[model samples]
Target: MPILTPEERIGQVLAGRYRLESVLGQGGMGFVMGGKHELTGRSVAVKLLLPSYGAEAEIIGRFFQEAKAAASLNHPNVVDVLDMQIDDGEAFLVLELLDGQPLTDLLEERGKLPPEELFPILMPVMDALAAAHEHGIVHRDLKPDNIFISKDLRGRVTPKVLDFGIAKLTEGDSSVETRTGGLLGTPHYMSPEQAQGHKNVGPSTDIWSMGVLIYECLTGDRAFQADSVPALLLQICTFDPIPLADRAPELHPAITQVVHKALARELPDRYASMEDFGGALFAACREAGVVLPATLEELFPQHRPTIAPGELSAPPPPASEPEPEPVPAPLAKKPASKIVPMLSAVAVLLLVGIGAGLYLATRPTPTPPPVAIAANTPEPTPEAAPETPPEPPPETPPEPAPPQDVTHRVISEPAGAEVVLDREVIGEAPLAVTRPGDVASLEITLRLRGHVEQTISVTEESPEEVVVTLPRRRSGHRVDPVGAPALAPR
Candidate 1:
């Protein structure tokens, strides 16, 4: 039954209600068919799960999960879930048909979206995610492919969030949960917690994915990248994203702050909720002077104004003629003798003012007079008083010097490991690591592929040269420690 092509399923009736009329779309899971309600003839989209997946209880359960999750959130920015059914072991969902394209297609067509075009579309997505989060649902797999930019009959843009298939319910709802430490979501967009396969993934996980998507939308590139999936996941778990300032320096600082906050490696440091994330982003957009639609209705009004081609190129209407200016009457000339005396008086006053200004400007700043010691103040005891040597004998002895900075020659058994001194990466081992003289001790962290990370402290009393032998990781792909400096994106 799974062998049939999408065309073969056309003209077939599902549960004697939705009749598959045409193939709307297809994916690895199954086909999305344009259908009509048999009784009402209402146009609808039917998402048919591939017959092979019907026997896979997990997949079937998730199929129904998407329906329940999406159906529960009746938001303008979220796609509407109509009905779901399983007929002859073929599970499917009914969704409202959309007119436009997925955000993936738009990004492909136009490499980078400018702030003016991006905020309207992006803000709504944030709002939709915020609504989903309110219901304790986290869309773990949010990416461009899951964001559909739909157009109403009037042709106004209204983005709808799609594909809640892998969504997780955080409130212990009836939705199926991903096994503990099971990895899900695309490699590039996974949060640190997701890459570590943490079971307690929450709203902050979605915030991380949104940050990646936003970074890509602003600068046609992924924030984190590597050659392989495991390598990418490791990068996501450990490394910081390529800085937005480097990717697109022209972007406003407010926007970059929001992005970095969303992409924070530590969950506690990240936005607390989708509302906070969206509010910060929206505020940043406004600060950057990027105008956004107040609401979906305002964005996609019931009736949109249209202009003809001729009107676009037509000349504007002419203005009324201006009145002519009146000519000024000639003034009587003043007597030469009277004018000379007045000029001389004016010159004398100007000279006096100039001399006064120069005198004030050239005056030197006065030194403040020393204050006399108070008569009632207590006198210093003989032991407390410093011996002046009766005169300023010789230059004052040099003040006791501060603790000298210590430089340690650090080397790992496996050379070329990343060496971090006091949380700041100082070249790779074998390297001369330095610590501030003021600090009592310095923390040194060494990391190398396939080995467990090793951290040691260095102090003035410790040996100048230090050596560490790292043990091999029990698992080849161990989750690396996060909060390192961001690796520049390639």
Candidate 2:
């Protein structure tokens, strides 16, 4: 008999039931087919393994293994496995026909998605994971390709989890056990522990992958990228993903915090479970005033209120009225106060005198070379003493020398934060400036976006290079209004 391709194998009736229509899609382990039940004539998606792979007991076992894993989960977000069979050299599994495309395709079409758009889809996926986790099952391979997003009859974009081929049962179900240290997940989506091929990868591993997925969904960028699989694995192990908030500042801190917790490398540092992660995500959405969609149709609801062209040309809708201001009751007036022109005059004069003294004290100092000259010059003998006798030695006072200039280089962790000297904007950071040595103090400040203003005291003993790593602003820190220094006159 001639060998038939997977597509050629299509249309062939299998076990007197499913009649394959055409190849729907292909994957690393198996390909899906659009088919109809012969007796019922109902539409369904059939997943089957390649014949060559099916000939092996292990691959055929895994094909059935996936069917078993998915059959255990009873959740709407998870793909429902219907049937499985092995006929001759062919092994196939049947699944519900999804109405929409994979998340991978959607992401490829749209660079990055807004928070409002991704929240609903993510909510259901997280729910599915939570349900699976409760049963001690971990979806070891979770990537955009395995996440099927479909539109139901109601037009709700429902996201369903697909492909449990490599899923590991943590409760010791005694099914097929993954060989220890066997690499079994997509490189880009693998967690640090998973990438390391650790023997006992747990739910936290799935949580890490979910974090990377959410990050990409919100930011339109991969959390980690490399040229090859080994390089990608190294990235997963060692690199700190660029923070989601840094890429999308509009995201609420609560949402970003949830991601940070989920992606934490250490087990204790990360969210304890999917439940905690979900709760935090929901709390963040609530705090941000984002209402989650409860209905299937709400997955891709109207992002902004729809307005007609005519309405756009018309005056804008009135804004919400502000709270009424309180009116204070009238109070009795006090008697007239006496003015003090004499004290004001004294204060003005004192200020002027102090300013003048400061100016004189900072005057350019002259170098006294005569003292050095005297030290270098040799005294004349007794012959020259007669001529020198005419000029009586007179007491000469030495003058103070002028201040020299010193240079200091300033730098910051994220370069380009504004540099301030004594509250005056000198220049942006990564700067070199010369200051007079006579100055009493140099108060240096660095201001960067999303970070609290950093201040430092510079002295002569300070190092030549001044570097400051600005810290993120603390919550509840007061924002000071613009003003000058308060002065108390004596």
Candidate 3:
């Protein structure tokens, strides 16, 4: 059978309450369409898998598994899954229609983002992952393309994580089987373990992928790149990524450290949970003085604890009440006038005797004698000899001078045009730069290893400053071209 045209695709979606209006987009697995629910008349996005994959038992299982995982999660940052079905050998998913662009599209236009701007976008993505992870779901394919930046009615940006078709459920055994040399995710964002064909991946795998996504978003290049998939895999396994500061110097050291830790080749070294990762990322952003839009809950949903039966019920009421008041008494008083006159006469006689005694105690006494002075004429001649030569004061040693202030800035660069700087890496994007007080001559060196170093000079104006727009190295590697593959008929 020939590939179904747009009209044929729309006809396939019209069987149920959904009425297809136009083509939204297409990818390796399927095409997304703009549609409306007939009963509710609400706009929705319908994703129809290609006929070839829809008929396969394994692909069908994976599709349903994705639907189940997504259905179990209900988060503001996650795209809502309305329904799923298989009709006439074509499987499709109905999702809440979004009015925004994928992060991938934005990245294509702006190679990398400043730390101040990158965290706001990343926080929500982490939040969506945290929600899915809580529900025992791992979004195995967590690339920029799977993240969308949509706006609410108030025009505030809302990140919606999409495409869970390749996500794995952690509660039970994997429902779908894998083929050798047949990985289930985008090559650029897949973790080292995933690239090595390991099947027992869990939340850590998603964490690794998220690390790569953030690395790419801040540096304008994937964490690992090669001429082919095998080379990329080798790099992911053995190579230490170029420091983020070398790419985006404006990012704080804490921010770069977080990104590096997330991309750690070993899963144990990475963050334990998406929530942990999100918190670190957010904290780094704040330390760098970058303001983010959403709260931690908005980025990572809070776990709702389950209450057992009869745990929070109210208690019983009171029993009774009772009575009255009472009264009280008085009396007794007597004379003071008779005692006053006798006491006054005694007090006057005592005052007269005390005044005479005080006058005799304070009188001054007479002075007495002075001794004779001894005069020696010989003592004056000795002083005149000492005045001839006064010994010079001992020379004072000079104090050691303070150490010269050395301003250090490390800059890292990838492909395209962005630079990252860090004093000492702590966690995520937006590194801090420390400079000397006096206008010191600052050297900005761009290193993309295997490429020539581009050195430029800047004045030390601010202690912690970031410069984002920088020139790219002419000799660095370019992105590989994506190609279309042929799909078999249903």
Candidate 4:
């Protein structure tokens, strides 16, 4: 057998699609190469398995298995697989070209991470896990080496997950999603069930691993440490990791609660879903006053119960009716003397009324005289029409459009700046922001990641269109301007 030298590997085209440019890296499974598409000229990363590993049935199966697993997912955080093939008995998969370092290498260079530092890096991974779990997929091996951190077109930090070879497709009748388990995952991050080689390893195992990873990120030390892999597995199976607060006293105490809940040994005691675990961790971070990107808000959407459009709210309880006011007792009967006097007056009045009527009826009736008619009545002339009043002279000439407010197109030199008017976000640049009608001038603020925040006042003197150059923010100085979010995270 002959060794595959770097010179022989470079400059070769694969499947008439990707042309190898250079070797990016090498791992136990295979070596990855930087390649470009021959037709579209798009940059790509090509991972080819060594013939020695390809010769083994299990290694070869996992290589092709990675293709199928990654191909099944369609998420921003998961690496995109462009093509997969077997050439001359060696298997290789083509993936999207990533422009950043792996999380493992990053942790090595920069030891422990703080809340503000860890938030943006961990959020996308949580979102990716949530998305995968939604589709009955769980990444059994989720360590730092598998996570990649990169930046997007807007200079926003992005975290992507790579290598889904050992990922378990969890869709079956068993309560535990997986039945094929033999101490899967690294010893330091594996759950008790996984360490014991139980066939019923489920999503909680992933949650447990994430908790261990979080602790490591915060302390730069593994939760469980031992001299040998076997001893480490024994500790993970029996003992609980030390509290995070004890390890890093400066860290927020709320995170300790999150770590405890997520790393609970029992499935029922642990977080039920990935969304729950991730949301709790971020929520704890927020409470501890950590500076997190605004995009983290989307991770925990309010679960509003589904109601039909025509459904109506229950009617208010019927108002209680007031009882009728009690009537006063009738006054005592009037005296008999007063009653008799009244009766006498009534009789005399009735007799006088009868006599007057009789006299009027006896006096005879007089006859009305008859009218005489002329042979022909002359026609009367028609009346003249009434005149209409004149409308007031045309209202004072036309009035001009009100100058109460004006709109200015706000733009940044590098563009995509989040615009704020009087502390309220209007939109992202290049966008039009109108000054409020009540205020003559407004404090317009423009903010972008990796750029200094600029707040200026827009008055009648300000130009209709304005552009401000934003200086790049130096490393270790994360900017969180008050306005809108510059990036929409996965």
Tell me the whole-model lDDT of each prediction, alpha carbons only. 0.73, 0.70, 0.65, 0.71
Q: Clash pairs of candidate 1?
A: none
Q: Whole-model lDDT, candidate 4?
A: 0.71
Compute the lDDT for candidate 1: 0.73
State how far residue 344 of model 3 sits from its true place (Å): 33
Q: Between prediction 1 and prediction 4, which has the larger lDDT?
A: 1
Clashing pairs in 2: 156-296, 365-402
Error of 1 at 37 (Å): 2.1
Give me the displacement of residue 209 in model 2, in angstroms: 0.5
Candidate 3 regions exceeding 4 Å error are 1-3, 11-13, 169-183, 297-490
Of candidates 4 and 2, the better by lDDT: 4
Best by TM-score: 4
C-alpha RMSD of each candidate structure in angstroms:
29.9, 27.9, 24.3, 18.4
- Writing each residue's lDDT as its tens digit, candidate 1 over 68-137 gives 7666666667777677777777777777888899989999999989887887887778877876777777
Candidate 3 lDDT over residue span 321-426, tens digit each = 3333553333223454656677787888789878877877777665757867687635554444444577899999999775556444333322232232342223
Model 2 lDDT vs. the true structure?
0.70
Where is model 4 more than 4 Å wrong at Cα? 1-8, 56-62, 165-185, 303-403, 406-430, 433-490
| Superposed Cα deviation of residue 132, candidate 1 (Å) | 1.0
Residue pairs in collision within model 4: none
Candidate 2 has a TM-score of: 0.57
**Regions of candidate 2 where Cα sits further than 4 Å from its true position:** 165-184, 294-490
